[model samples]
Target: MIRFVFAALLSVAAATAQAEVDIQEVTSPGGINAWLVEDHEIPFLALEIRIEGGASLDLAGKRGAANLMTGLLEEGSGEMDARAFQTAREGLAASFGFDNYDDSFSVSARVLTENRDEALALLRAALIDPTFDDDAVERVRAQVLSIIASDEKNPNRIAGAAFDAAAFGDHPYGSSLNGTAESVAALTRDDLITAHRNVLTRDRVYVGAVGDITAQELGVVLDDLLGDLPQSDAPLPEDVPFGLAGGVTVVPFETPQSVAYFGHQGLKRDDEDFFAAYILNTILGGGSFESRLMTEVREKRGLTYGVYTYLVPKDHAEMVIGSVASGNDRIGEAIAVIRDEWARIASDGVTADELSAAKTYLTGAYPLRFDGNAPIADILVGMQMTGLPPDYVINRNDYVNAVTLDEINRVAGELLRPDDLHFVVVGQPAGVENTN
Candidate 1:
């Protein structure tokens, strides 16, 4: 009853916040396409740009080159040195950020209407003519090396790295985005230049803009900003063969609590039954306090402080992963409970009441994501990159609501692999031995 009331209140809040958001697909004179949501009410504009094939496109020998190159983008560009570039940005009172992830390189910028053109020019310079100065390369390389060193002693990182290696084998996805200390130390300025050119190309780019910009003006901005990037000739990574064999692989570490990373193969984002599988996951573990995993492992038995699961639908691979940390003595019990819950959900599915509650929370919480212009712009670019239709923003909640119990159960039975679940435990946990 309490769950139902919370869901009802959230549904009301979502309905109240639902305003008509008009998205226009604009094509620039130079043939660049972008999604735009114009709101003249705000004096600021937020722009988001994504280039697919991010760090995954790094050269075979240089694992961290793409990541290093992304950091250097703002260090210096064209004629402006690092200090001069920053001074110019501060003068305009604008913000720009560049980031490299496993599958994409993203640029986010926010600027007042009066300084939009200047911000765009600065962004263009960074993208087109990055200096990759010798000093900047060494400086950023040291920072990355520091992080890699720190990750070596982090149990969670250790477990994740081991899990990826076991699941992906020789695939590039198995490798860390930051690369090893030796690999990063060996990176050169020329490598950074090549990585920059290979990853940030016109063919792989997607753009989304929101705020006080018209379609005509946005089209002009798109062309002026990205028209000159080299056409992408870089080959994308191949699909990873799913090879996550079941059983625990324990890395002995001295800690009071054992942290475990566990999962099995998962469905792709474009699968017809994705919505059903999504809701099934919610009832099982995606929901926080109300989820079966949390309720069983944390609320009832207190085996762990928290436990959760999520789906990772990458461009080249898909996975359903989860994690939990518990006292060494009780970690085994927690793992058993998680596995039991997985099997039960697969066989029995969720109840009608559970289904209704999942739908309410999922749909109601979605509208909260659109609270800001920058966030909306980010979502728009992500939608384009993922091949979602322009109306996805408006119809997404309907898709969640349309899921029925039958569909959810059928998907659960098809997708869950209790016997094939793999676990990587990182700590000295009693009764948990390495089975690799």
Candidate 2:
């Protein structure tokens, strides 16, 4: 009966999650801070850590260094080889995930209360003392190269690459964090070592822990896990403007279906009108079937299977982006429909019925996201990264509900730009041509 109650607690945790989440701001003896949601009902816990300056920390020539470093984090640490590391993690019956993005690096861990210390020790080793062995480096490098190769042939990847290149030019956002085959293949162990130091520094880390942990215990754990990491000396990249102009950028590829990525500059995460924009987008293109884009593009004309849009407020830049895929023969028509809808929404805005529907769906569906401790921990870290207060969980739905019809329409009129909306279509379509 060591930790047999964990399964039962999971059910109670689910109910607790679906109702309310109480967050505690924790500060370690060493000055590190983490958000905590103590659920002693469970003998399980999830820890999530997000570090700023992820792949963007890669030095000028080392595009994929941070990504490769993140991949190798669990491959081995200190004296352990890949196989030994795997065996240790498996023996503890724990789970860990590491990922790198343009804006952030994330580490996620799940373990029983009994094994939390050992699992965190494993995590700390990966973060702080990774060996980055030569064999492991080559093995992971090959995988990166294979991904690059695959991306080259993927229409979606090609479209995204083209769009980013056009929008951000030489900014880190312009290229894939996966790096080019040439760049990834050329990365050395020294590059990874430097990347680890640059990306995992103490100053840029945000953490969230949930279940079977207290503030007192988490403070000590935080100090042990993160206090050893050095302060980052690498400066964050400068913000870049959205560089693409309005129009279709047709990339000629041999595929029956054309995939397109379209967007223009968008509002930042902290913009006062952000909640209004959030509601506006749902009515316009973000709410799946009922969104205007889908209704116009798919339900009415049957031009494409799906079409949607979202506000991508990255740390350094912001964008309103959308995508659609359709047969090469029908893609031009789909683009035309999308453009028309874009213009229509920009000018006329949305009806009252639409706004109410969006608000209901948005507010009603949010609680479902907190299905378990891991998800709650993720949301906690995400809130921290976005500079939201601890009470944001309780207040977020209110923000959505409080948005007025006039406010959302006003935001829609200002935010939606028919003139600046652009499309990067990848396929050999009959009528579309490169306008970039």
Candidate 3:
């Protein structure tokens, strides 16, 4: 009876939901603010801290500094080495993690209600006082550099690097998050300390928690984790202004297979036409097996095992990327099919059925993203980080439903440019000639 009642309540909540999510904002004694969603359905609590100014803020000379700092946070901290810290958390069956993206670095924890106290203590230590010991720094640096060096030999990496360089010349977002081998080699403990000081701010940080914790308790956790961090009066860096030279950029490699990447720019997250663009992308390349690209390029012709496209919106700009992996012998055929499909979508708009199916798939797939507390917490933090209204998730389906076929067609014609398509191929083609 209780479960049934909760389900009914959730349905009501979903129907009337708006940007004002059912979240409570709590202020800790130490003055840190936290946004929380309380759910007693599970015995665990998930806490996330999104600190503004991630890898994109990597100082001109120090490309990968912020990324390394994120990794060192949990490697050791507050009177404990990495192993000791791992053991302490394992004893309580709690999970602690750290990650960095182009926009922010995040520290997360999931712990049972019974072990909240221990989890809080460890979480605070990792955030407040990291021990970037000399040996630990050297070890991590060596390992990271070794991997970057290995990538230098991989054709796929070569193609991607070349494409980004050509597409967005000097944009910081174009740089690799995993710094170059030389850059990682030059990093020292002081660089990590500087990154933490400059970017980690209580004001710039947002807190999110879900599962077994109440608003008040989660507020306390945020205070403990971030209260003492430096405060920032400035906002995150504005989006990068990126311009593309849309043409073929081929990085000749010795391998027998060719990897093709093509497309141009698109809209950012907060763009008014996001839903329209998203639904249109599903019909073009993003909807997997049901997409026109998949059907034409893979399922029907078998030119490649997998082929797809997507819109990757950055703070300043966005890019439409399409890719295919195929044999060198059929490289010409593969590129021809990709370009033909691209032009078809732009010139000849999708059918009513295609548009309808795309919208249905997108609307139906919305709730699958919130299956668990951790996923929900991640989405909440991401939306918050991107300056989206809190009710964005709850109101998503409505916006998706509001997309008209005309709106999608307009975006398709505006965004997809086969004539301006920048093609990049990374492997040697046995019989395929380079037409362009």
Q: RMSD of each candidate?
A: 6.1, 1.7, 5.1
Candidates ranked, most accurate by TM-score first? 2, 1, 3
Give the clashing residue pairs of candidate 1, or none.
none
lDDT of 1 by residue, 1-436 (tens): 4334434433433343433468999999999999999978656788999999998998888999999898888899999889989988877777889999989999998877887898889989999999988888888889999999999999899999999999997677898989899989999888888898899899888999988899999999999999999999999999986688889999998989999999999989999999998888888899569999999999999998899999889999999999999999999999999999999999998899999999989987897888667778888999998889999998998999999889998888989989989999999999988777
- The runs of at least 3 residues in candidate 2 whose Cα sits more than 4 Å from the true structure, single-residue gaps closed, are 1-16
Which residue runs of candidate 3 sit more than 4 Å off their true CA positions?
1-21, 25-33, 233-238, 430-436
Which of the predicted structures, 2 or 3, would earn the higher lDDT when compared with the native? Answer: 2
Would you estimate the TM-scores of all the predictions? Answer: 0.95, 0.97, 0.90
Q: What's the true lDDT of residue 259 in model 1? A: 93
lDDT of 3 at 95: 75
Backbone clashes (count) for model 2: 0
Give the range where candidate 3 is weakest over 10 consecutive residues by summed lDDT: 12-21
Q: What stretches of model 1 exceed 4 Å from their correct place?
A: 1-19
Query: Which lDDT tens digits does candidate 2 get at residues 315-428?
Result: 999999999999999989998888888888788888989999998999888989998998999999999999899988899999998989888878988998988988999989
What lDDT score goes with residue 411 in model 1?
89
How far off is residue 187 in model 2, in Å? 0.6
